[model samples]
Target chain A: MAPRKQQEIFDATLRLVAEKGYDGLTVEGVAECSGVNKTTIYRWWPSKAALLGAALIEADVLGFDPPDTGSLRGDLVSLVEAVTRLLTERPSGDIAVAALAAAVRHPELDAHRFFADRFAREREIFERAVRRGELKESADPMLIVDMLAGAVWMRAVFRGLRVTDDFADAAVAALLDGI
Target chain B: MAPRKQQEIFDATLRLVAEKGYDGLTVEGVAECSGVNKTTIYRWWPSKAALLGAALIEADVLGFDPPDTGSLRGDLVSLVEAVTRLLTERPSGDIAVAALAAAVRHPELDAHRFFADRFAREREIFERAVRRGELKESADPMLIVDMLAGAVWMRAVFRGLRVTDDFADAAVAALLDGI
Candidate 1:
């Protein structure tokens, strides 16, 4: 089967898992939802964990659109806005928040790699900013990324705080000052 | 039932839930862990969710034994160190992280109020410094606190980063210099 077919099946499976807890998702359900065969699903992923994990890593949950703005500050503003937009948009943010909550319960077989693309992107963004001299040379990209993303995640998942342009500005400014 | 007894039962439940996911926990399990009667467990807290939420809030997971050091930088250093110590202490952090994870999936019933402490203490520290004139009057305490805790939590929970004194200092320095 083409990888696009695999992507289609994975997308459907994510929606199923997000809507219905992981326990509620099934290969049959995914196949039924996506018009893909169960055999095709199994052939690509050894377990449901693998299938879902791959989707989170590859699928743009945040669609984490990277900023090409001339400076790190602009990049940060752009990133926060995108993140705020993603969280405000239905289903994507809900799925992500739900998935993170679920990941802890099944730490042994979490459907997403805690160490994959998302984390990597965070590091890369900060490092790139440093390279561009957008931030101080001493700034640790990893820590900066963690602070920015962490605040957003905490607000969305814990406080259920709505993101606003003012919020985005404060958070970006905090990053500017805190960095 | 004494509130203290209720507190103990809740503590036991939290540890149990952390060590053994929600599926593995029970009222009887908490009773066994805390040496309280099964009757008392239900008497004070009607549901596991209520018990857990109360325990999570009262346990002071984010409590900081700040050193009251004279300087804002020093105070923040002390705060970060305390946070790191708490995170590394054991089942407390583990259970706190676990409960938060669970809360996301079961949002309706889960009202983990860890952020209440986080934000409160955060504002207190920054505002105190502002009053002392150690920090800019314009400094946003909420933003500062978010940046500090956000960096630590993101590293500890998401990235599995072993937060060290060095990391904390770097974070503090980054924030101080940025401002």
Candidate 2:
């Protein structure tokens, strides 16, 4: 029951967003879909943004934290593969894209906590690489992280560009080579 | 007169898409708004997707093709600065964000030919550098470009991330250091 309540909310939230998109998502709709009361939903989260953010946090999103493999290439493949898989899989990319678009207009609610935290986590991963000296001291780890993260997302989500395994290998090779 | 006619159509197309989104954009709406006949619009392009794609291309905003400044650092700066300008100065990012979203549904027409081609062009610029020994021979140009473009669009468009020089600088620094 403990897990059920939380899972219900997150599952319901994902489906609603996927089906209706961010604009059509509503607390009322979530409650109706999940069979949870609106008051119960609000008690847990201040608003729909909070609820949605919480859902993303709660969901296993293929692990945003990049793993520390001894080599930079190993670590990158781990990072890129996970992100690539996420984007390639159903609903994750779509949900992410929709959430981002919605956040633009409702920045006060969506921007402050969840979004900043996500960026910080991304930076934290890169900073670790810098500390380990797996990368150049002058290299901007955030830039590297962005390059990896950005390419996959832009291809899959935005431009609908495709990334093959050969492409991924090339990407890993290029970043290591260039930086 | 020649430039103005095309400009009017592009302007009207943006307004229409922004107001009604890509799905709602009509040849009729664009024609009426621009005071150009529907026949004229159709005679120029084959479909609504064609019209929209032309508008994006007409805006000339696939971001700048990076100029060779000898130094990758300077080249990177130039590239980032160019994108930063495009992101801030016009509704370029917004239109792009919209196009990507639209592309998800209308894959062939919008994403592959228009946006993806421009994205590919940027990758080619970097890849050639690799070939010239300016960058690492093994450097994955396509992947790096994906990251560079994705990170910018993700932060600015999705997160309501501001297009500050500092942001671009940080991104450039991070990318150079990390990758």
Worst 10-residue lDDT window for candidate 2 chain A reads A104-113
The models' CA-based lDDT, in order, is: 0.70, 0.67
Query: Which stretches in model 2 have alpha-carbon errors above 4 Å?
Result: A1-3, A61-73, A104-115, A122-139, A166-169, B1-3, B60-76, B105-109, B120-140, B163-179
lDDT (Cα, tens digit) per residue for candidate 1, span B1-179 = 67666667767887787888665678889989889888877887787777777777665443344467777888788777766666666876787667777777776446536676556656666767888878878777656666677677777766666887597787787777762
What tens digits encode model 1's per-residue C-alpha lDDT throughout A55-121?
Answer: 7676644356567777677777777676666656776776676566666665644533644566666
**Which candidate leads the pack in lDDT?**
1
CAPRI category for model 2: acceptable
Show model 1 residue runs off by greater than 4 Å: A60-62, A108-115, A122-132, B60-67
| Pairs that clash in candidate 1 | none
Provide fnat values for all models in the order shown. Answer: 0.55, 0.50
Per model, state how many residue pairs clash: 0, 14
Chain A TM-score of model 2 comes to 0.82
What range of 10 consecutive residues in model 1 chain A has the weakest lDDT sum? A107-116
TM-score for each of the candidates: 0.88, 0.80
User: Which ten residues in a row are the worst by lDDT in model 2 chain B?
Assistant: B58-67
